[model samples]
Target: MLFGAGAGMLAGLACGGGSGDDARPAVLAHIGHDVAAPAFATLHERAGALVAALEPLCAGPDATTLAAAQAAWSEERDAWSRVLPFGFGPLPPELNALDFWPVRVDTVETAVAGAPAAADAGYLGGLGVSAKGMPALEYLLWGEDPGAALTAFQSEDGARRCGYARALAVDIEARTDALATAWASEYADALATAGTGSAAYPSLKAGVDEVINKSIDACLTMVKGKLDNPLGNLSGAAEDPSLMESRFSGRTRADLQANLAGVWAVYHGADLDAPAAGISVLVAALDPALDERVRAQYARTVEVLVAVPEPLTEALVADRTAVQLARDELDTFRRLLKLDVASTLGVTLALSDNDGD
Candidate 1:
């Protein structure tokens, strides 16, 4: 799971034997242009929508408005989760600013109390990770009782919370825009031109390998961090939903679902926007049976996740068996990913820049 240069089975996979080498450029292009670019673009758009939705809620705090804002946050958060697994090039520095979880509730409380100006991205960005990202917003918008939060927003201190929330949303919007612009203008080329003496990635395979590893890491994170860590999948351990991502918003289940969706996108080399010639095509060409197995397992894993109840933190205690079942399913998915996918692609996994993440 550690993010270092990938070796192991992928290094042993035979390479340079067929048209596989020739397919690298097309695959890289698909990843940079078709896959990554659209995710960022959509993220940027969704972040903007989130800000717009927040504006209404801030101006008039109520249950209906709060619900609308929460829905918007989920939309933006889903877009962001899809893009997070592609953590390379121009992404790492911005990730924490986007969604640092297990958010410091105290820091967010302080920031809300201070109610700094909302127009300043610099000021917003300088705030602690917990105070400026999605998790912080989750706390403000949906804490334990969203009704109470709504009431508070309507109270005298409502302005402070609303103002702070606006500032955070503005910061998110700006960061997403910058990311989209960077990928479109520069980072995409860095990935597409990898291996042509590119400093970031010595070879196209290295670029592809980095993404593949990130996808694998993303899956592991879902299993260990999102699911098992909170569910206490280990024997005789009590579950702890408090450790779950987006617990304040009851979004833990949705986050893993989004994570799985991201992994699928990375494997197939496509996203919500368009389909691209991806590693799946190459793998299918190389080994149809392995490709089919991976596809089936990936689909099944997502299904298992979808079948798990929402507010996964609660599901962990109420129906721990379901959580364990999902964990087992993810374990299978991870093996096929870390072992079969890497071997078929003839690319080794490496440490992501956010390695050990």
Candidate 2:
């Protein structure tokens, strides 16, 4: 609502709404950059894969047991494979359409309970009850019984049951991966089998298309992860500073600043061309004038995002629900650095758009 201010008015400028005018353009510029099509598309694709990958991490036990079980199940899978007559081995076309979410839950539950991560994992108390229990389950118990009403995934005793469930999930993952690998193999073999754009070109093209489209989806998710996603929905596990020390190590503040730069570049044009300078400016401004309390809150939030194990996806999908809220507040504090969008020719000019937003 107010606008007239200068460096000489710093004291009153900080106290009154005079700063809002300066802030508005900066915020808008940030929004434009943040939500730009290329950035958004890149992140959206990545987040989709990350959500699928990390969702299974907390399941339990370890990778070793899960692998063993999957190996055994593959033998059985062959039986299913042989009975089919379609291209690329015998997997149920109908089941393949069930989508990854179904398979994701199914697989993670299987791996965690079998070994390395946990002893048991289940939904609906493992009662096999399709109703009355929440559709998805995430629970971990340490030497305690959750009682009969709850689906129990016991380590030693329950391992037998949980192991099989875990195995089933691992089997599903393998089945899917196998399909991709087989397609790639065929593509590669065909490349040398014939001349360019020959009889096998169509087959190779199909495989390439499938993989590229899949990658594009990952990129789209990455954009979403950067701009959206939230902290609460990510993991139930509590923060562990020791783990943080192990993973990030040394200059925590610097690391945090780098993260800000990455996020900033997407929407704020925080100098992708000059990352260090952008991060330095952001950190300097953030530390002194911004509310320390709020800064600390945000700092912790970023910490969680970094630890997420998903690949090609930003670990921030959990925050998808709260992104609007964050953006609304962030709109107040957004800042930008001005730079020339120079033409390839030697001509240089100052555009009025130097909002320094």
- Please name the candidate that would achieve the greatest TM-score relative to the true structure: 1
**lDDT minimum window of 10 residues, candidate 1:** 2-11
Highest lDDT: which candidate? 1
Error of 1 at 181 (Å): 0.9
lDDT of 2 by residue, 1-357 (tens): 223444423322222222433232232223223322233233233323322432343255355433333233322332222211112122234233212211133443443444433323243234232111111111121111223211343235454445334433433344445443443444334422222343442332232222222222222222222232223222344322222211111222222333343444432243446422312232233233333433444455455444433321122243333433443333222221111111111112222221222
Candidate 1 wrong stretches, greater than 4 Å: 1-21, 117-119, 122-126, 234-236, 271-276, 351-357
Query: Per-residue lDDT of 2-92 in model 1, one digit per residue for the tens?
Result: 1333232233233532233366667777888888898899999998998999888988888888898889898988888888578877889
- Checking candidate 1 for backbone clashes, the offending pairs are 3-351, 4-351, 6-349, 195-202, 195-203
Give all TM-scores, in the order shown. 0.88, 0.27
Badly placed stretches (over 4 Å) of model 2 are 1-99, 102-151, 155-157, 173-177, 190-214, 224-357
Estimate the overall C-alpha local distance difference test score of candidate 2: 0.30
